[model samples]
Target: MSRRSRPVVSNRVRRFFASFIFDKPAAAPASVIARHRLLNAGAYDEGSGTINGVMLIAVAAILISAVALGGNFLVCVSDARSAADQAAIAGAESARDGDFDPCIKSRLATTLNKAALVICKVDEEDVTVKVAVKTAVPFAPLVSRMARAGPVECS
Candidate 1:
């Protein structure tokens, strides 16, 4: 006796044809069923809500901390620039007035602005100043800025 070979049809194809014939589909794989159950394990549990709330609060706190640090950095940069400009103007004015040392006034101005004067140069009526602002934030670098002031002659 000889047996005839029959073509094999995939589960997806069988399911599609079964649906058209109003027949039941095949059962899903064990792994898929297990994953679905695991995903919904804590769906109706009261502890899940608390866990989710705690995660949200942690995320919000981190974001707020980052924004505060960023704002502080910007303030530090602005302070450095302002200090440099004030020091340069002070030095230039002192130079024009024939003060014994223009850099002395520049250093005083920076100190008053809560910054340190890194460099101060006076040439005739022109003055250049560099100031640094140090922040209390850990790991933050010192902010520095430079400015120049002089008498401008226009014809």
Candidate 2:
């Protein structure tokens, strides 16, 4: 073939291969490419603003739950202590009357409003009393199934 024709044929073959083998491989959809680039660049970091926000929210939730639990515990403890005091007083009174059952029953009845169980025991010179109180809090049906504060003594 003449030199000029040779150049023409070579150019034609090159163009054919370019079209078939290397034409811009379909540009990945823009969104797909963007996601890949973001991942490759490590755009998400543990110390980033989004992570900090999430940590703050978790801490706040934990603190609120703790406060609620503490409040319920305090209520139960206070009620139990009050019942114990009342029981001791009634037991002492009953000892004077030489009757134990009636005094214990009366004390328990008085503390019903506070949702507590009261027990009284008389021992010669000292009256011993025990109280178990139950309190209801959100989510928890009953806090401290039985909260025992002390055996208040009365002489």
How many clashes (backbone N, Cα, C below 3 Å) per candidate?
0, 0
Strongest candidate by TM-score: 1
> Which 10 consecutive positions of candidate 2 have the poorest summed lDDT?
142-151
lDDT of 2 at 101: 62
lDDT of 1 by residue, 47-155 (tens): 8788999999999999998888888889999999999999999999999899999999999999999999998888899999999998756678788999999889999
TM-scores of all predicted structures: 0.69, 0.49
**Candidate 2 structure quality by residue, lDDT tens digits, 16-128:** 56666877444445776798888889885546987889999999999998888889878876766666666666656666566746456435644663644544555663566
RMSD (Cα, Å) for all candidates, in order, is 9.4, 10.7
State how far residue 7 of model 2 sits from its true place (Å): 28
